[model samples]
Target: MSSTRKKSSRGREGSKNRRWSDRVTKQSNALDLESKIFKSTNPRRIALSLKRSAQASKRRKGTPYQSAMSMLNFYINRAGKSLSQKQKRVLERAKDELRDVFGRK
Candidate 1:
C-alpha cells in the first residue's frame, strides 16, 4: 500500500514539473524588452528604443508598431498599481511619441 501511495505521489510530481516546464517555455518564447524600456529617463528616447527593439525581435507577434505598443502597454499595466502619477504621465507621453515615431498616428 505504501509503495502504491509513493508511486501516485511521484506521478503527481511529474505532472507538476511538466506544467512548470510548459509555463517556462511559453514565457521564454516572448521577447523581453523591459530592460530597454526602463533604461532611459527621457520618454522619447525610451519610445524610440522600444520601437527599435520590437522591430529587431523576430519572436514578437503582430507588426512592429503593434508589438512596440503592446510592450509599452504591458509595462504600464504591470507598473500601474505601484508607479507614481508623474511616472505614469511620462510613460503615457512616451506612448504618444512612439505612435508618432511609428507613423501609427
Candidate 2:
C-alpha cells in the first residue's frame, strides 16, 4: 500500500537527519545520574564483593605443588608412546623434580 510505503520512507528520513550527539548526550546523562545516585547510598551497607576469610583460605592452599604433580602425572602417563629417548629422559627428570618439589620422595 502507498500509506505503508510512505510510513517507511518517513521513518528512513527521520533516522537519516537525526543527530548522533543527541542520543549520545541522553545516554551519557542517564549514566551520570545513575552513578551519582549509587554513590549517595550508605557505604557501610554495601555488600562485600570478596570475603576476607575465603581469600585467606585460598592463599593457605598449595598451588604450585598441585600443578606440578598434575604435569608430572600427564607426562608419566604419556611416556610409553612414540617418544624419542632424549624426550623420555627429559620428562623423567621433570617427574623427579616434581616429586622432590612436593616433598613426596
Candidate 3:
C-alpha cells in the first residue's frame, strides 16, 4: 500500500476521535455548570439584576415617565433572554406601545 492510503486511514480515525472529543467537551461543560450551580445558593445573575432594578427604581423618583421607561427597559432586557416565540412577539408589541406612548411627548 502507498503512504497516501495509510494517511487516509489515519484521517478516518481522526474524524471519529473528533466526534468523541466533541461529546466529551460538551459533557464536561454541563457537569462543570451543574457543579457551579450546586455550589452557590444564590445565582449571581439574578442577584445582580435585582440590584440594578432597585437602583433604577430609586433613581426614577416615582415619576410617570421614569416608571414607563423603567418598564420598557425591563421588557426589552427580558426579551433578549431565552423567551418563547409568543412572548417575544408580545414584548415587541409592548415596546412599540411604549415608544408611541412616550414618543408623543
Best by TM-score: 1
Ranking by TM-score: 1, 3, 2
lDDT of each: 0.70, 0.37, 0.41
Q: After superposition, how far is residue 9 of candidate 3 from its true place, in Å?
A: 44
Positional deviation of residue 39's Cα in model 1 after best superposition, in angstroms = 5.8
Question: Of models 1 and 3, which has the larger TM-score?
Answer: 1
For candidate 3, list the clashing residue pairs, or say none: none
Expressed as tens digits, the lDDT of each residue in 1-105 for candidate 2 is 455533455666778656544343233321221222112223211111111121233332445445334423443354234556665565565555445544567
Arranged by lDDT, best first: 1, 3, 2
Using all chains and alpha carbons, the TM-scores for the candidates as numbered come to: 0.65, 0.31, 0.31
Writing each residue's lDDT as its tens digit, candidate 3 over 12-43 gives 77777655533432343212212221122233
Compute the lDDT for candidate 2: 0.37
For model 2, the run of ten residues with the poorest summed lDDT: 44-53
Reference-based lDDT, residue 39, model 2: 21
lDDT of candidate 1 over 1-105, digit per residue (tens): 355433455666677665543343235354545453553567898788878777788987788888778767766775344677787888889999999899877
